[model samples]
Target: MITLKNITLRRGAKVILDGASATINPGEKVGLVGRNGAGKSTLFALLNGSIHEDGGDFSIPAQWRMAQVAQDMPETDESATDFVLAGDTALAAVNAEVAAAEASEDGERMAHAYMALQDVGAHDAPARAQALILGLGFQNPELDRPVNSFSGGWRMRLQLARALMAPSDLLLLDEPTNHLDLDALVWLEAWLQRYAGTLLVISHDREFLDAITNVTLHIESAQLKRYGGNYSRFEDMRAEQLALQQASYSKQQDKIAHLQKFIARFKAQASKAKQAQSRVKALERMEKIGPVLAEADFTFEFKEPANLPNPMLTLQGVSCGYPSAEASAAPTTIVRNVGKSVLAGQRIGILGANGQGKSTLVKTIAGDLKPIAGEIVQGKGLAIGYFAQQELDVLRPQDTPLEHMIRLARDTTQAGRLSGQSTREQDLRSYLGSFNFTGDQVKQAVGSMSGGEKARLVLALLVWQRPNLLLLDEPTNHLDLATREALSVALNEFEGALMLVSHDRALLRAVCDEFWLVTRGGVLPFDGDLDDYQRYLLEEAKRQREAIKASATGQAAASVPAAAATAPVVNSPLNASSTAKPVPRENNRTRQMRKELEQCEARMAALSQEKQGIEARLNANPALDEIQRLSTRMAALQTELDGVEARWLELGNALEAAT
Candidate 1:
């Protein structure tokens, strides 16, 4: 267990935590949450022993092993798998002992070292590392690629994989989902649920916290408050506490009055996920949390559009992708043959796995990238407000909010997009003030601002345009919970067509009415809700892992020495035309079939074992909810077993034919 009694922590002259006390029990998954710049990371640094408390008692179990994602950007050229494998400190220690024992030529020491190596599971370390790598969204082939070859985000993912690969009693993850796609995020949640360790994570992703954490640690006003249950439960309890404060009641009432308009709008537009009972329940909960959301520090709504077009834009067999740098080279098409219409008041969420062109489609529609083929017919006098995934795309670091707005006002007016709009400095400053950029903040360089401020600046620019259509890609990536809630409310109130690509499920659930799936070089309506999409992503990940396993098996079979083969070779009708050699040799097709057969048998055995374990748990009489979950899993296992059995039979018939 960890304990902090009357702890006072400070960064230089600023006191971050004053008289803060908290206890974290063993094996607890605690989500450390707070508003941005509330010293969450500072607290994490203290927990990790990077700094000490300014005053008071702070202690942790000395024997507990701690693992955390390294914040430093990795600069090594090591293979990804090898780099991750190095995180297994226990295995590495055992191997070092083995080497020392061998050098000493001591019988007893060598015996113990070998046993320790086996105990640490050193033989399968590479496989374990590769599994972590793949689960974090890396391809099988990329496992052998150098770490430095990947981009900054991909490298960060590798860092996370390395942290997870370590055997530890305590794991510290800070914003683990920031770089992950929805599929990877889902896989990570499942992994964390199965982890038998104490976890402390700091993340702004509400859904992620709700899914994996049971305890919430909130830091506010120089104090640490512990609450039982997940983030949503914490929010509910906090709201109740605030409601009890008589002085704040009247203020809250005023905010609630302001929020009533959004609530009415929400009621008017029924949930697109009506078929999902859980989503419907979430909608009901949102209605209850209206007042709490209204107390947020920042909130702004889009102005009424200059014009409303029935069909904002129409794609006629469009291809969304990137153009080649060389004029002679062909453009790379990611999402092709997309014939869709964006009409007034439509809210569409773009869904896809990483590298599936969700962003490409949005960029094409935002007019940042031209379509590789076909046409996009825009309504006359149509206006678009686009929020890019990267701040660099829309913001200049050296410029201030005032400069950005002034330039926007001038350019739009000169281009006749914002006819008769005021370009006066005073007018622009007032406009920026609505988005919380006031006083000297309007003059501060954009690069000096926090991520939330930068995002807010972009929103200010977009809303000022009074666009009929909004294209947003990962806009909530840097936003805190309160800011995200504010954005949700603002978006709900906006009477404009919206197309968004984001990994933030809460934002998607609140803002999108329909979903478009970008996959396999094409676009189509998903015909399902977010819940169904998550399940599909899980199944797709499983299939991909299986395919990777088969590919690995085939590679191993191909690398085998021809002379080491034990099975007799036979020519089937499929290869009857080949001339026979004097010495019998195994054909490539036969070898591949054998390898696949072996893999299938292994999978069947694993499934049977897992089913037996589930049966044992079920027979033990677990809780009602646990029983239901286990039953669902059991059914899925049975279905998979049936498919595997059918494939086994087919393989047997094929092998017999070859014989």
Candidate 2:
């Protein structure tokens, strides 16, 4: 078991953990919850022995091993698998010992070394590596490619996979889901479920925690409260505790006020002089409970902008794609003959294979990239707030939190509302409080803040914008469980239209009212519910499998090699087809299926055009999310489409034989 006993952590003059105590039993899974700067990360660092607390002790059994998932990757030339394997230092050492013994002429040492090797699975390293690969969602052959070739996010995944594979009794995962996509997230969830060791996961993903954990440890009022059960259960208990604390606090204040009044009135009366003196003494000695805070209870209330008359944005015959004339004899494109309009109150979600152009579609709507073959018309008085997935790059490390806010403020004269009138100090303090930065925290430099804090700052600034149309690209990344839940509440209550590109299935289902499946055929509108969409995806897969099997294997060359699968789909010719269905009035399963089928037909011509357009834009601007989402989604769609074509070929063969 791993335990923290009466631990107190202080940075300079500020106290983060005051006499906090907690324990994790063998095989127990606990999720740590707190606000942005609530010392969650610090506590993990302390547990890892990376940082020492000012006062108190962390107690863990000597027999147990510990491992931490690093948030940042090393600037090394290691392959993804190699980087992950580095986490297994003990196993590597054991392997090296075995190698040395094999080289030795002594027979006794060889027997002992071989036994040690068996204990660490040296005899079956290939199988062990494959298991780790599947657990971490690195089944793609491309994962064998040099880690330097992949982006930072994928590298983070490699780090996590390695930490998980380490022969450790305790796992400390800090925001492990931030860099993972939806499919990878699902895989991770399942992997953690089967893991036998103890786990302490610090993340903002609600579904992830709820799915994998059984207990919650909350840091509040200079103490750690251990609650048994999952996140929802913990939340219920937390609310009850907060309510009880508030009631007790109010009662104490009322008693104090009553005592003071009694003392003032009777002190002058000789008959009750002794009673008054007793009352005054009682007031001084009484213990007080501070006001209860419902975990990060600051609310977001944005002033709604003027309503738009037409769709928030409209695209006409828009062909968007990136062209690589140098790589190919002809330029490659992802979207063609695509046209669509997004109106007010449309919670559209873009989905396609990794390279099918989801982020390209989002960027196109956000006005970052112009469509190559069509007009994208922005509605009048449209206030747009765009949240890029890699928005952390936009932050300035040198500035203080206040400086960042002051720069982002629309009217400097509106300063009175943000910072105290004419006093920069008061303004910064209050504004920081909205995002939960307070006391000396506002004075601290932004560079020192954790990744989670910076992410919250980004969200806080975006909320300050009060935009009418919110376009979010994975906005939920790097958030904690509590923050993600609060975000769900805020987005649900917001008045503006939301167009989100997220791999967070739970977040999308909770907030989105509609979904636009960004496919190789273009954007097709469908029932926004994740469950419904999943059913459609499964059905599509099943249909295509039947199609592929019925047709002779040599008939159609639709299957793109997985190695080349990440590239744009410019060379393929997708014939225009009729498959348009009206939007469903009620989100029933049958109605949803019919709507999806129709929308797919109506979207064929437009989708072709969108593919071409996205390809061209990708060629011009090589953004990672845009490229990956489109590529993955397009690959899934192509496999399905090939199955359909293969089936069509089989039917033709059958008809010819009969004729």
Candidate 3:
């Protein structure tokens, strides 16, 4: 159990929490929630011992072991499986003692070390680690790949897996589902439900919090309030409380008004002067009930498009994927022969397992990537507003929100979509203000802003574009619950075609009228809702695991010698002779393909960094000559990056083929 008694916390001059008190009983899964920048993360820091409370007392069980995902990017050559396995600190300690004992030739010490190792389930450690990795969306083959080989997002997943692998009495997870797809999110929900420990998670996904959390701890106005139910129930309870508070406030105001009226009427009369004095004293001694200062809800809507484009976009034998680096080389097709029409007012939710080409399909439709084959027919007056999965893909970190709006206005004017529209700076500021960007924030660099701010900026840009078709990929990733709710409302009201890919089930259910599932290198309409899709994902995952296990067993049996094949094999965890079988080795070509894939990814990352650097310098309002020179280099870098990314995709395709 954890206790916080009259805890007061501050960051610089701002008081985050003032005399806030809360008690979390042992094994209670609590969802800590609040508006963005309302000190949810700051509280997590206190719990993790990163910072001490400014005043009052806070305490946790002294013997409780805590596990949390590290915030830093891991850079290591250790294989993913080995990296995750190392998270079991107790088992590692036992193994270390065993090695030391064996080196010293101490029979008694070695026996003690072995006993400790057995107690920690050393023999099953690898299986447990692999299970965690797989559940987090790692492929069976990726388990043995070096940790450094994964991209930042995948590496973060590995970090999460490692955290889950660790033995602990208390676990803290902050935005764990941000990097995951729907399938992985579903898997994680199931896993957390089974975890036998005190769990605390901070997430914007309503469904996720509701599924795994039993208690809700809300931080608001320097107060920590606990509710004995999940997020939905907490919301209901809080709304009721607010209503009661407002009623009480109204009643108090009426009583005070009556008292003031009586005192005002009697003060001038001689007979009632003494009574008036007594009334004044009574009023002075009365506790003034503060009015309910309700937090403003974020609300915004997309302006009507300049024109409605029926059959906004149509695909004909479209193979959506990445082109090859070499001009003559074949492109790597992710989703092939996609034939679908995005008509006006269509709401399509894209569903798929990770790596099943949901993003590839969206990117292709958004025109970020060209179709490898076939043709896409765009309707007359078609205008697209694309929200990329990653904010950096759509935003310049060095640019300000005002600058982005200015450029968008310029582009819209040039395209003849806004002939008579005002393109003034004041107009742009007012428009940005509608999205909650105001004052100094409008001029702040995108890189210096929080993720939610960046996301809002992206949304603001999308609304300003007045596109007839919107392609949103994980739009709610960085948004808080309020903003996400606002977005859902806005999207529902939008009079245009929409194709959304997101892990937020609430948003999906609210915005989408139908679904398109990307799987097995193709796209098709899904016949059911999100619930059915989730069941399908779970079943598919289980089938894959079984197939992999069967394949491994077959391969192991085939690899054994002819004489040894006749021997009866007894499978028992307690049998010392039943050693774990080795996984089959990768062929030379497969290994070489993996090596090339890693190299290509590294090169692409470097090129992207350099491009960003040039863009940053360009946005600094450099002199004309320097600006021209940097712009030329920036164009060249973009071309080079495009080619590198193409090569990377080609290498990825080759690796998948080998697998």
Candidate 4:
């Protein structure tokens, strides 16, 4: 349990939180929701004791240990598996010993260390570690390979995994789902649902928040308000709140106007002096509109591309990304080769495990990267509008909103592709207004705007360009869930061929018709709905993991006698405790086979039991009437189980063959 009283947090005189107060009880899952830059992270820090609030007392049980999932990490040579294991401080020390022993050169010490490793269950570490790695969307062979080789996004996933793996009384997760794909994201959502402690997550993911959060804590106008509902219900409640606030504000304004008239008229005549005084007293007593919060709704008109034609973009035997070794081994071409024909109004989503060439493929499409080899053809009259993930990089700091718009205006006579009468007044005003940008904001320098404003400006510029083809890379980054939905709606209505790279599952589902999955191995064209795409990704990843486990378990189980394998395996604690013995070379083959068979059976039994258990739990959920996070997780797990079973059966046959 934690409580905040009269909390005020300021970052350099900029009010992050003003007089915020709230009480979070043990076992409660609260979602901290606010617009971007509203200090949701700062508030989380305050609750977690990472940062001090300027003026508030936040209290919680002394026994409660709070943990925050950091968003950044220092570069290191640590493997992704090792880094995640490091999350458990206890496991870290144990793993360090094994690493140290492996590094030592003495043969005698090596044998002793090997025995110690077996006792600690180090042999099975690969299986457990691979599960986490695959669940986090790192299909990179480099995960067991090295952290130093990964980009920042992959590194963030490692850090996220570490924090999630660490046991604590309360978890303060800030955008935990940011870098995760549908497979990883769903796995994480399911894991968090069963996490045995309180959780307060700061996320713009409406689906995640709606599923995991039991309460919604709003940080607005320097105050904290609690809503007893998930995100969707919270949205409904907020609508009601805004209505009440507007009604009250309007009534007060009317009463104040009447009083002003009375005061002016009675000041000289003394006829209405008492009534005017009474009205002034009433105004003083009135709760002044609690921090006038502005509401912004993005309702944009689609500027249909001129003379748009079908089959906007096509890639046959075309690949994207820095070439992997397999691709690199053959010829000088690195990007590899893939195939796809993107048709008219194709709302395609590109998804793959991080470190795959998704960004590279999109870059190739944008002409930012050269494919090592492939074919790409653009449709006739196709114009291009590209949005990169780093909106800041794409936008000019020196440009004002109006200036940016003016720059987007093409000289119609020169290009001769479309109309050239684009004036600063009409085009600039219309574009900015489409993004909900108005008044002084139109003249404000882009450098002075917040991340959200910058993102909006980028969209505005894109809309003005009016290209027949739109390529968006993580456009949902700065936008809140509400704005994201609005953007999704706008994109759905927009008449263009869309190729978007995003980790937001909900957004992908809303905008895309097809998917281009860029695995480090190669690119695969996924022509299916969002659900099918998710299954394909997860199944592939899970199969990879099961294969790894099957290999390791075969090796591990090989040490035991086949005749003794008839006994049911006892439940073993994951922590290192069991002592293991080596099998003589003669019995090694069958013993290994038996171990693999047992491991596969155990997993099958566990999954089957878990499936039924989850079903009962779902039926008995407390908030059955309310949409819950468990529901989503249940669906994801069922998918996971399906994949697990399919693999389990294959492994079972293999074990039989070996025996």
Ranking by TM-score: 3, 1, 2, 4
Ranking by lDDT: 3, 1, 4, 2
TM-score of 1: 0.78
- Of the two candidates 2 and 4, the one with more favorable TM-score, higher being better, is 2
**Clash pairs detected, candidate 1:** none
User: RMSD of model 3, in Å?
Assistant: 9.7
List model 2 lDDT by residue over 22-119, tens digit each. 88899999999877677888888887888897777788788888888766666777766666666777778887887788898678988888788778
Candidate with best lDDT:
3
lDDT of each: 0.83, 0.70, 0.85, 0.71
Error of 4 at 306 (Å): 2.4
lDDT tens readout by residue for model 4, 311-360: 78778788543322232132222236677777777787887654455665
Candidate 4's clash total is 6
> Per-prediction TM-score, please?
0.78, 0.70, 0.84, 0.70
Per residue, candidate 3 scores C-alpha lDDT tens digits across 176-212 of 9988889999988988998999999999999999999
Kindly report which residue stretches of model 2 are placed more than 4 angstroms away from their true locations once superposed: 107-119, 122-139, 254-287, 293-296, 314-320, 325-339, 352-356, 372-383, 395-467, 479-490, 503-506, 518-528, 531-659
